[model samples]
Target: MYISGIGIVFTRGRGIDSFEKALKEGWREPSRTGLIPAYRVGPETLTDASLSKKIRRADRFSRMAVLSAVDAYGNSGITVNEREKLGIILATAFGPHTTTFSFLDDILDYGDANVSPTKFSNSVHNAAASYVSAILESRGPTVTLTQFKLAFQNALILAGSWIAEGRCDHVLCGCADELGMVMECACKMKLNIAKDGKINPFAFSDSPVSVPGEGSVFVMLSKEKGSNNYGKVGEISFSQNITRKPDLFVIDTDGMSAYETGYKDIINYDTVIAGYSPVFGSMLTGSAFNFAAAALMLKNQIAYKCIFQDNPFGAKLCVETSAKNLNEIYCIKICRPEIKTIVRLQK
Candidate 1:
């Protein structure tokens, strides 16, 4: 059984109370018609040591990753044995862009003489993963991935494959992206930043731009289905360089033909979890937010809508099941200009 024990920390809310509040209020920033409500962390919420330790070394992305990882482990309710085989897979669209720009700024201003090695090291895409492994004392495999919008999905597929291949029995999968000065500059330069500085996802538009926000989310995956577990991953698949017909298009398609092809193959699923909003804020790890919501949906046996505006690549949906059947089946259809592929998921 492939299921995720989820943890999430976002601007929309923190912990369960905040999360539920945001959902209940249906908070949406009108200016950024394609983004979710932003969440912010206050100094009072963090200990001095935690705040001070990260001040000089960690970027917004890294901090989010660490906090989300901690939350995920706590929510899983399963203590990881020191000897258990574990793996980590993280995904981000703009990995450590904030820190990367800081290093560049130092070089541009000081010609490298004052460039801090520690800052440089922490700026790497895998820095968050490294810190996570060390903090958890996990010695198993750890890797990071980037695929623009598909990074989290790729991570899930990779994590699942590792389990299927007997590489690990337990794995932690995560996604994180952060807002920074550089990101703000880019948005302004591109003229994509909303005047009101928010993101809206359901608005109808041919060109959709998102506000920038920061957050991270993680999930624990296991091969064995414990009685207390939320749900199991039924199947995961991916396709690159695909081509198919255009009628299947929904809106501003961003390399989503493969996902649509996957959707057509799904037949039994009634609910879908989507991550399109996270990316609207210029955060690449949109799927991480979707993963958090998906876990909740599965556990509650609820179906929810993930709205996308003028989606040309079809909307991403996750179906939840209430029946006590072991062999639930789903079909997904992906289409490109010249190619069509179908995959099936069964559990």
Candidate 2:
């Protein structure tokens, strides 16, 4: 599948321009105003006057997904005469947990029968996908997937299959997750929280430090190449054997896993490596964010400097933002040294 456009909602800002600016600005501290240091998407960033009245009752998770998907469609600039040919696939690790908590609070504070119906409706895992499809008016197949790991990658694999099966011509493939009091409490009790407000991607430690984050990223994908292309996503594999070499490698090592030392095994001495968790914060579905950065480099023909470059392993990192010839780029997500997932992007 080829990338026609990209839309993103992150802590730094909204839309592709905001994402690129964050890349150029390099490392910035996470918000300490929350229970923990997190790259939480602000309420102001999700406000869209045009969409406010339409999605007035939608939750934050659905709002992020709707905005990102809408932006992707707008950025593609491809006039779709047939909305039925457009598909949507939304992947999330934890879908709207805060909404569920709110519904539970209503039941406890009031009564089970007296709880708000809107809160219950928005708490489901597929609510984001429903909002995306309803707002986009896409009649094609809409799927919502939830997995702790490889959620985005799995969604990509399925999207390619959907096109291959003649189910849809274009797919709005992306991911959305939100950080709230529930997620914060879970992260504190389960993972190692970074107190210093900086994620050392080079740490590569067994007990990796995590600064929890939440956002949404969507890409317009099609079987055929379009006028504007980020690159082509093909040869997606779950096996460890990687044959093709790329201009550079974007590794997703944001300290979401228990053992992140496996990431170092894939590093070659010649190829430069980059990890962008510091810019976007830590999430299980961070592969989507990393892919966004790689797509920008290929589409714009400029490599952004890597942020938070603390070279513990002495790995050759992309620390400079300059114009260069980038024919190919690979966005890799490694669950373990033995089990690896790769998405090869060709110019």
Candidate 3:
């Protein structure tokens, strides 16, 4: 399968150009106004006056997904001969939990019968996908898969299966998540919250720190190459030869997910390493963000410098942002010391 187009709504900004600008620039500190510092999306970024009536009732979670998915469809610039042939698949770890919290608020403040129907509707995990499909008028199979582990990579795997099974000609696969007050309190109590809001990928310590972050990313996938193609998503594997290195190894080593020390074994190879979790913040869906960066690199044939150059572990890091011949990139996410998900993209 090939990645024809990409749309992203993240902490820095929205759209593919914004993502590329973030990569060229280095890492920035996460927001600190809340109880737990996070990479929360600003209100201005989600403002779409043109589609206000279309998504008037969408909450922040839905807005992120809707806007990102919409951009993914438009970014592809492919006139769908049949809207029914285009499918939608949204992958998320925590889908609209903030809206769920608000719905609970409605039940607590008002009676059960007095709950807001609009809020209840938006609370469902599939609401975002529905909004995307409705706005795009895509009548194909729409799915919402939720998992705390490998959500985006697993979505890619499923997208491949759907294409092979002749379910649809194309699939709009995406991820949406948010950092609400309830979730912030939970992360504060449950995880090691980074005080300065900076995640060090090179800190391969058993005890890793995390600064919670949230946003959405969507990619248009199809078997045939489009005019504006990122690259071909060749292999989606759970287990692969770690010894076989690509031109670049894009590691999703955000401190929140796995044992950081586990990455020590994988980095011993000779391929140049890159990780962009610090820019987006730590989330189970963070691999999608890394995949976006890899896709941009593959499309442009350029290697972005590692966000933070302070490497104590002496891993082969890309220190300079320069033009390079990038033929293949392996975006790997380690759920545990043993479990690994690799997405291979080739030029």
Give the best candidate by lDDT.
3
- In order, the Cα lDDT scores of the candidates are 0.55, 0.88, 0.88
Q: Estimate the overall C-alpha local distance difference test score of candidate 2.
A: 0.88
Report the C-alpha displacement of residue 221, candidate 2, in angstroms.
0.2
Tell me, what's the RMSD of every candidate?
Answer: 6.4, 1.1, 1.1
Give lDDT: candidate 2, residue 145. Answer: 95
Candidate 2 to truth, TM? 0.98
Which candidate, 1 or 3, has the higher lDDT?
A: 3
Global CA lDDT of candidate 3, please? 0.88
Candidate 3 per-residue lDDT over residues 1-347, each given as its tens digit: 88888999999889999999989998888888899889999999899998999999999999999999989888988878788889999999989998999999999999898999999999999999999989999999999999988899889988999888988889999898898898899889888888887788877777778888889999999878999999999888886666577899898777776577877776678789988888899888898899999999999999999887667788899999999999999998877866887899899
lDDT, candidate 1, 1-347, per-residue tens: 45546666676544534543443344355323223323344333332355355444666677667767766766667777853478888888888887888889889988868897977998899999987787777777899887664576678778888888988888889888775666555655654544554443433323445555667778888888754475666545455222322111112122212233333322222233233343323454554564454455445444333333333434344222232222322222233433332222233
Regions more than 4 Å wrong, model 3: none
Window of ten residues with lowest summed lDDT in model 3: 257-266
Which 10 consecutive positions of candidate 2 have the poorest summed lDDT? 263-272
lDDT (Cα, 0-100) at 250 in candidate 2: 86
Task: For candidate 2, write residues 229-286 as lDDT tens digits.
Answer: 8898867888657676678888888888876887776565367787788889999888
Worst 10 residues of 1 by lDDT: 245-254
**How accurate locally is residue 71 in candidate 2, as Cα lDDT from 0 to 100?**
96
